[model samples]
Target: MKPSPTFEERWKRLTSRARMSIPDDFPELPPAFHTRVLAHWQAQPVESWEDLLATLGGRAVWAVVAVCAIAAGFVFTDFHEARISRPELEHVITLEAWIP
Candidate 1:
Protein backbone atom coordinates (compact mmCIF):
# COMPACT_ATOMS: atom_id res chain seq x y z
CA MET A 1 0.00 0.00 0.00
CA LYS A 2 1.21 3.59 -0.80
CA PRO A 3 1.88 5.90 2.14
CA SER A 4 -0.58 8.85 2.62
CA PRO A 5 0.55 12.22 1.23
CA THR A 6 2.01 14.77 3.73
CA PHE A 7 -0.15 17.90 4.62
CA GLU A 8 2.24 20.19 2.63
CA GLU A 9 2.00 17.96 -0.45
CA ARG A 10 -1.85 17.79 -0.21
CA TRP A 11 -2.09 21.57 0.30
CA LYS A 12 0.19 22.24 -2.71
CA ARG A 13 -1.89 19.88 -4.92
CA LEU A 14 -5.20 21.52 -3.80
CA THR A 15 -3.88 25.10 -4.38
CA SER A 16 -2.43 24.13 -7.83
CA ARG A 17 -5.87 22.70 -8.90
CA ALA A 18 -7.73 25.77 -7.48
CA ARG A 19 -5.53 28.30 -9.44
CA MET A 20 -7.59 30.18 -12.14
CA SER A 21 -6.32 32.24 -15.10
CA ILE A 22 -8.48 35.06 -16.64
CA PRO A 23 -9.16 34.75 -20.42
CA ASP A 24 -7.58 37.41 -22.68
CA ASP A 25 -10.83 38.26 -24.59
CA PHE A 26 -13.22 39.44 -21.81
CA PRO A 27 -16.70 40.73 -22.94
CA GLU A 28 -17.47 44.43 -22.11
CA LEU A 29 -20.91 46.12 -21.50
CA PRO A 30 -21.81 48.92 -24.00
CA PRO A 31 -22.15 52.57 -22.82
CA ALA A 32 -25.70 52.84 -24.20
CA PHE A 33 -26.80 49.81 -22.11
CA HIS A 34 -25.43 51.47 -18.92
CA THR A 35 -27.24 54.77 -19.76
CA ARG A 36 -30.54 52.91 -20.42
CA VAL A 37 -30.26 51.00 -17.09
CA LEU A 38 -29.53 54.24 -15.15
CA ALA A 39 -32.50 56.02 -16.82
CA HIS A 40 -34.84 53.07 -15.97
CA TRP A 41 -33.77 53.16 -12.30
CA GLN A 42 -34.23 57.00 -12.14
CA ALA A 43 -37.74 56.71 -13.75
CA GLN A 44 -38.95 54.38 -10.93
CA PRO A 45 -40.65 56.26 -8.05
CA VAL A 46 -39.23 55.94 -4.47
CA GLU A 47 -41.72 54.23 -2.15
CA SER A 48 -42.49 55.64 1.36
CA TRP A 49 -43.65 53.88 4.61
CA GLU A 50 -47.31 54.74 3.76
CA ASP A 51 -46.95 53.12 0.33
CA LEU A 52 -45.45 49.97 1.95
CA LEU A 53 -48.29 49.78 4.55
CA ALA A 54 -50.89 50.30 1.79
CA THR A 55 -49.32 47.40 -0.15
CA LEU A 56 -49.60 45.22 3.03
CA GLY A 57 -53.37 46.18 3.35
CA GLY A 58 -55.41 47.39 6.40
CA ARG A 59 -56.38 43.95 7.77
CA ALA A 60 -52.79 42.65 7.73
CA VAL A 61 -51.53 45.79 9.55
CA TRP A 62 -54.30 45.47 12.23
CA ALA A 63 -53.56 41.77 12.72
CA VAL A 64 -49.84 42.55 13.20
CA VAL A 65 -50.71 45.33 15.70
CA ALA A 66 -53.10 43.02 17.62
CA VAL A 67 -50.45 40.28 17.79
CA CYS A 68 -47.83 42.74 19.10
CA ALA A 69 -50.30 44.07 21.73
CA ILE A 70 -51.12 40.51 22.88
CA ALA A 71 -47.39 39.65 23.08
CA ALA A 72 -46.75 42.86 25.10
CA GLY A 73 -49.71 42.05 27.43
CA PHE A 74 -48.29 38.58 28.09
CA VAL A 75 -44.78 40.01 28.73
CA PHE A 76 -45.89 42.96 30.99
CA THR A 77 -48.81 41.45 32.96
CA ASP A 78 -48.14 39.98 36.44
CA PHE A 79 -49.30 36.39 36.94
CA HIS A 80 -51.16 35.83 40.23
CA GLU A 81 -51.39 32.49 42.08
CA ALA A 82 -54.81 30.98 42.80
CA ARG A 83 -55.77 30.55 46.50
CA ILE A 84 -55.21 26.95 47.78
CA SER A 85 -57.92 25.20 49.78
CA ARG A 86 -57.24 24.14 53.43
CA PRO A 87 -57.28 20.40 52.49
CA GLU A 88 -54.86 20.96 49.58
CA LEU A 89 -52.47 22.95 51.83
CA GLU A 90 -52.68 20.19 54.51
CA HIS A 91 -51.89 17.51 51.88
CA VAL A 92 -48.80 19.46 50.71
CA ILE A 93 -47.70 20.00 54.31
CA THR A 94 -48.08 16.25 55.05
CA LEU A 95 -45.99 15.37 51.93
CA GLU A 96 -43.27 17.85 53.02
CA ALA A 97 -43.34 16.40 56.60
CA TRP A 98 -42.74 12.87 55.18
CA ILE A 99 -39.54 14.06 53.31
CA PRO A 100 -37.78 14.81 56.68
Candidate 2:
Protein backbone atom coordinates (compact mmCIF):
# COMPACT_ATOMS: atom_id res chain seq x y z
CA MET A 1 0.00 0.00 0.00
CA LYS A 2 1.14 3.55 -0.69
CA PRO A 3 2.23 5.47 2.42
CA SER A 4 0.40 8.68 3.37
CA PRO A 5 2.37 11.95 3.39
CA THR A 6 3.63 13.25 6.80
CA PHE A 7 2.37 16.59 8.24
CA GLU A 8 5.64 18.35 7.35
CA GLU A 9 5.58 17.00 3.80
CA ARG A 10 1.90 18.07 3.39
CA TRP A 11 2.64 21.53 4.78
CA LYS A 12 5.64 21.98 2.49
CA ARG A 13 3.54 20.97 -0.53
CA LEU A 14 0.77 23.36 0.50
CA THR A 15 3.17 26.31 0.99
CA SER A 16 4.95 25.67 -2.33
CA ARG A 17 1.60 25.55 -4.20
CA ALA A 18 0.49 28.77 -2.46
CA ARG A 19 3.74 30.53 -3.38
CA MET A 20 3.40 29.50 -7.03
CA SER A 21 -0.23 30.71 -7.12
CA ILE A 22 0.61 34.27 -5.95
CA PRO A 23 -0.55 36.93 -8.48
CA ASP A 24 2.19 38.75 -10.42
CA ASP A 25 0.46 42.13 -9.89
CA PHE A 26 -2.20 42.06 -7.18
CA PRO A 27 -4.68 44.87 -7.83
CA GLU A 28 -5.10 47.46 -5.07
CA LEU A 29 -8.51 47.97 -3.47
CA PRO A 30 -10.45 51.23 -4.14
CA PRO A 31 -9.56 54.26 -2.10
CA ALA A 32 -11.58 54.80 1.15
CA PHE A 33 -12.65 51.13 1.10
CA HIS A 34 -12.27 50.81 4.86
CA THR A 35 -14.18 54.06 5.46
CA ARG A 36 -17.04 52.98 3.16
CA VAL A 37 -17.18 49.49 4.72
CA LEU A 38 -17.20 50.95 8.24
CA ALA A 39 -19.90 53.43 7.23
CA HIS A 40 -22.09 50.60 5.82
CA TRP A 41 -21.49 48.43 8.89
CA GLN A 42 -22.40 51.31 11.23
CA ALA A 43 -25.49 52.21 9.20
CA GLN A 44 -26.99 48.71 9.66
CA PRO A 45 -30.02 48.49 11.97
CA VAL A 46 -29.65 47.59 15.64
CA GLU A 47 -29.93 43.80 16.10
CA SER A 48 -29.41 43.46 19.84
CA TRP A 49 -31.32 44.79 22.86
CA GLU A 50 -33.84 46.82 20.88
CA ASP A 51 -34.65 43.85 18.66
CA LEU A 52 -34.90 41.54 21.68
CA LEU A 53 -37.24 43.96 23.45
CA ALA A 54 -39.43 44.40 20.36
CA THR A 55 -39.73 40.62 19.92
CA LEU A 56 -40.20 39.89 23.61
CA GLY A 57 -42.54 42.84 24.09
CA GLY A 58 -45.27 41.17 22.03
CA ARG A 59 -44.54 37.83 23.68
CA ALA A 60 -44.69 39.45 27.11
CA VAL A 61 -48.18 40.76 26.37
CA TRP A 62 -49.19 37.31 25.16
CA ALA A 63 -47.71 35.74 28.26
CA VAL A 64 -49.65 38.15 30.47
CA VAL A 65 -52.85 37.42 28.58
CA ALA A 66 -52.28 33.66 28.92
CA VAL A 67 -51.56 33.96 32.64
CA CYS A 68 -54.67 36.12 33.14
CA ALA A 69 -56.80 33.61 31.22
CA ILE A 70 -55.44 30.76 33.35
CA ALA A 71 -56.08 32.78 36.52
CA ALA A 72 -59.65 33.58 35.42
CA GLY A 73 -60.24 29.88 34.76
CA PHE A 74 -58.95 29.00 38.21
CA VAL A 75 -61.17 31.70 39.69
CA PHE A 76 -64.19 30.02 38.15
CA THR A 77 -63.08 26.66 39.57
CA ASP A 78 -62.70 28.22 43.01
CA PHE A 79 -66.18 29.79 42.69
CA HIS A 80 -67.57 26.42 41.78
CA GLU A 81 -65.82 24.79 44.76
CA ALA A 82 -67.12 27.47 47.16
CA ARG A 83 -70.61 27.06 45.80
CA ILE A 84 -70.40 23.28 46.25
CA SER A 85 -69.18 23.61 49.84
CA ARG A 86 -71.98 25.95 50.97
CA PRO A 87 -75.15 25.10 49.13
CA GLU A 88 -77.29 27.07 51.59
CA LEU A 89 -75.81 30.43 50.51
CA GLU A 90 -77.06 30.16 46.88
CA HIS A 91 -80.54 31.38 47.87
CA VAL A 92 -79.16 34.67 49.22
CA ILE A 93 -76.77 35.32 46.31
CA THR A 94 -79.18 34.67 43.44
CA LEU A 95 -82.85 35.63 42.83
CA GLU A 96 -83.48 32.70 40.45
CA ALA A 97 -84.07 29.18 41.76
CA TRP A 98 -80.96 26.99 41.89
CA ILE A 99 -81.19 24.51 38.97
CA PRO A 100 -78.69 21.93 40.30
Highest TM-score: give the candidate number. 1
- For candidate 1, which ten residues in a row score worst on lDDT? 74-83
lDDT of 2: 0.86
Q: For candidate 1, what is the lDDT?
A: 0.85
lDDT by residue (47-69, candidate 1, tens digit) is 88899879888889899999999
The 0-to-1 C-alpha lDDT of every candidate, in the order given, reads: 0.85, 0.86
* Candidate 1: segments with Cα more than 4 A from true spot: 1-12, 17-20, 24-26, 45-65, 68-100
Best by lDDT: 2
Candidate 2 worst ten-residue window by lDDT = 82-91
Q: Look at candidate 2 and give me any clashing residue pairs.
A: none
Q: What tens-digit string does per-residue lDDT give for candidate 2 at 20-97?
A: 988899678887998898899999956899889998999999999999999999999987774444565666566465
